[model samples]
Target: MNTAVSQQPDAGVLLELDGIGISFGGLRAVDDLSFKIRRGEIVGLIGPNGAGKTTVFNMITGVYRPTDGRIRWHGRDITGLAPHRIAEAGIRRTFQTIRLFQDMTVLENVIAGQHLKMRQSWWQGLLNTPAQRREERELVEHAMEVLQKLDLADVAHEIATSLPYGAQRRVEMARTLVAKPELIILDEPAAGLNEQESAGLNDTIRAIRDAGITVILVEHDMSVVMNVTDNIVVINFGKKIAEGKPAEIRSNPLVIEAYLGQDDEEEDDPLLNAVHDQVNA
Candidate 1:
């Protein structure tokens, strides 16, 4: 166990993944990956599927402990913290599948995220007393604030399962946001969206960053990833291929090669083409 100081070289870094690696049985899902995210920045993690992007997110959010390496948040080692402890430490995430409570009202789903911080006892709830009522009221208000931020207030009373896929995605984000995390990891946020929905998601992500939370976005849409992310870290076959600003990443040969090797028909974005031309100048 290497007990090094958790801070990154960047004075503003809020999260650092130092020498992180994880494996499943004999398969190396992620191998010796390291990166740092600055406070209030939006960073993209991109690669071919099975590049261990989701596994990285899972480890950071405490779904799995890394087979080796360190994870730090705010100068504290958090490598193997429990999921709820990670959440309490101000990190939260939404899954690739948009895991919303289907039977719950949208507001109820968001309030559930406050589970780690709830102070009332089950006995208090059963008694239906003033303190429990006050807690419930506060929880509802907090849930509503989250809904309003995501512009989902109109559907607050609706069943989460009844919403469109895009709306369901918003609810997942809302649930995460209601927890007030300093770092939010979104996995494939634009996966099922149409062009318009993807664009809307871009706007929402920017709004979230502007509200002062750092964002780590895992996405495959080059156009969206290239346009919205401040920086990108590209991985291939469970290894880091490159890390740089969006403009730099857009033209990186290794990144292009990784994407091309994975899918021959993958389209290159106009921004990437423009950046490539500039890099050659």
Candidate 2:
């Protein structure tokens, strides 16, 4: 699956997952899934538990190689590039759970995200060469600008993990943003946020898109996805069941069936009613 690509996605397309599938031992985790993201779009990949959302993330980010298909970045196949190489290729992601440096200040944690861009040799570091010092200073300067951009500059000196839960999540995002990814993948970015916090997240996501970053998210919080994403892709048992606009997916019979079983009587069904009310809210 290792490929060398040298071309562009036709027109505005940024990334394409063409018939991608992956397996764990003999069990298929994702099957024949395909999607394309145009530049500056926010798309959501969602499904019920164990529906293979994260597996698709792993494959796209090069943590796993799709046994069945190729992943293209700007029309260049990047199916089996090493994870670091993929990061170097302007793709980065944040985990479902916040992962931050407990011992480092928020600014340090974000600054560390630039590890991939560090170019000084080890010897240069040992001697504290002028070029190395200049590079380090530049990284700090760039990280500070990102912190300000993300509204975290005031807490930049605080320990990353000591911040409130929502702020910690923003720190993780700041780290990812400091990497300057053209395509950012978010896994449940609003998992534990309260209503107010989640609403703020909608704005953050849009700002990222407006800043010319394409986003793909796997989120269990339907409200966040429905409100934040430009398009939604739904999957069940590793297969796509529906892909469409929020209003369309909110009422799709296939989506309702996937969330609630097919045996529902379709009358005054509280669970079904709740799902409809919740997502549409």
Candidate 3:
């Protein structure tokens, strides 16, 4: 409902959500939200549970159409495009739940993500034409290169699900990278990772931005969000509450109140206290 933080023009914004909103029956999951993600920056979308974070991702990826407003990719309106079409348009995402092909090898799973970019048709693939063979070779090489970038090439042939949980997370990232998207949306990427694993993941995310991909990171882990993100947009009850750099967000009274509530007991709670410690450190 607040348009104050809705728009801030940037010269090279890769993705723009202009007054986006969505509802399910009587509940408004996201209400007239707006934000812009500049190319090559890691922007964190953070909030308390049920804060419409994932709902925004769903709308951007076309998993759910916005009830109002437009989603633009490089200034082109792409609202309501099918999910596959969105992927083909150079927007890819990883889920909160790992979605790797359990039976497939790590390399195979990454290669599968390149389907939209593959030029060979089904018929050509069925016949195993020379061109198809060549393309397949190239695909393997490309997938391996992505795996190498993410430090997962050593386990390239292992069953995807057989790796350690952190490594498996890297596999999912490798899979998304193979698609060569302009924007990558990760939903709670550090969900199951321990502290050490989360630290490593933070490096991997920085690497992703260094690779020239803009990232919209939806995460609940305040430490990861605060440490890794270049900018943060905070929301609550389906509305934008705050948006700024990590330092500003860390000190914002609105953000502190949103997460800690207004009770004296809550002010001294572990979660809020940890947040204060991180922000001040």
For each of the candidates, give the backbone clash count. 0, 0, 0
- Flag regions of model 2 displaced more than 4 Å: 5-8, 262-274, 279-281
What are the per-residue Cα lDDT tens digits for candidate 3 across 118-189? 998999999999999999999999999989889988999999999989899999998999999998999989
Query: What is the C-alpha lDDT profile of model 1 across 1-281, one tens digit per residue?
Result: 44344553468989989899998999999999999999989999987767889999999999999988898887788888889888888999988887887689999999998887789999999999999999999999998998998999999999998998888889899898888889999998998888888888988899889888999999866667877899899888888999999878767889767665544343464333533444455
lDDT-wise, the better of 1 and 3 is 3
Candidate 1 — which pairs collide?
none
Q: lDDT per prediction?
A: 0.85, 0.86, 0.88
Residue 278 Cα positional deviation in candidate 2, in Å, after optimal superposition: 3.9
Weakest 10 consecutive residues, lDDT, candidate 2? Answer: 262-271
Cα displacement (angstroms), candidate 2, residue 240, comes to 1.0
Mark the 10 consecutive residues where model 3 has the least summed lDDT.
1-10
Model 3: CA > 4 A from native: 1-10, 262-281
Question: Residue 108 in model 1: shift from native, Å?
Answer: 1.3
Per-residue error (Å), model 3, residue 60: 0.4
